[model samples]
Target: MQIVVKDLAFGRINMSIEKDIQQQTFRNSYQKATVNIIFSANWLTEQIKIFLDEEHITPQQYNILRILRGSMKPLSTLQIRERMLDKMSDTSRIVDRLVLKELVEKKLSTADK
Candidate 1:
């Protein structure tokens, strides 16, 4: 993996990517872009993981919190899944964990009836 380092207004920032996964360079622009997007996602995930670890929360739980906070209102499990980065995630299970931690509150939505 190549850790690209760059200097910005804040200071030097580093992003890690898996370069060893493929020995040859990308065959085309699309291929390169695909790898770049995955790399960026993973890098972002790592940053989020480090921050959430201190709060004793998993990345999935942290993601749910962000979605709920962004809505500024309560959301149903289906609604949360629709808004999440990983739509395939088990919103109900993840919410249960967050609710256990007091990081989230869940109530039966009016629409659920």
Candidate 2:
């Protein structure tokens, strides 16, 4: 009757797909795998959000920063979006926010213009 979620901060590492979702059984391995992937993704996103929250940035913004840092060169917003973990993210808006926060700088691309 108790709901349990994996919380690394409290030293709780054990997690089971069946127990986590309160589903005693799955229809098949494919279904189980799908559900597990979704559940794990959501859990991971939550964890990332917690960390990002501490840094006062959204996941999208964090994704952009990571991409830019790894690229070691300027990338257009389109390029940033293409490399984003969440394709649905509004890359321009996130980049703008980052610019306002002074975490990232935006420059006009002469090549594009």
The C-alpha lDDT values of all candidates are 0.71, 0.83
Give per-model TM-scores: 0.61, 0.74
Q: 1-113, model 1: which lDDT tens digit per residue?
A: 11122332323454433453544566787987788787778766777666667668786776787777778567888888998888778989998987787777777767778
Candidate 1 off by > 4 Å: 1-43
Best TM-score goes to which candidate?
Answer: 2
Q: Can you list the residue pairs that collide in candidate 1?
A: none
* Cα RMSD to the true fold for all candidates: 8.0, 7.9
| 9-104 per-residue lDDT for model 2 (tens digits) | 534755789888999998999999999999988888788788778778887887788888888679999999899999999999999999898888
Cα shift from native, residue 13, model 1 (Å): 3.8
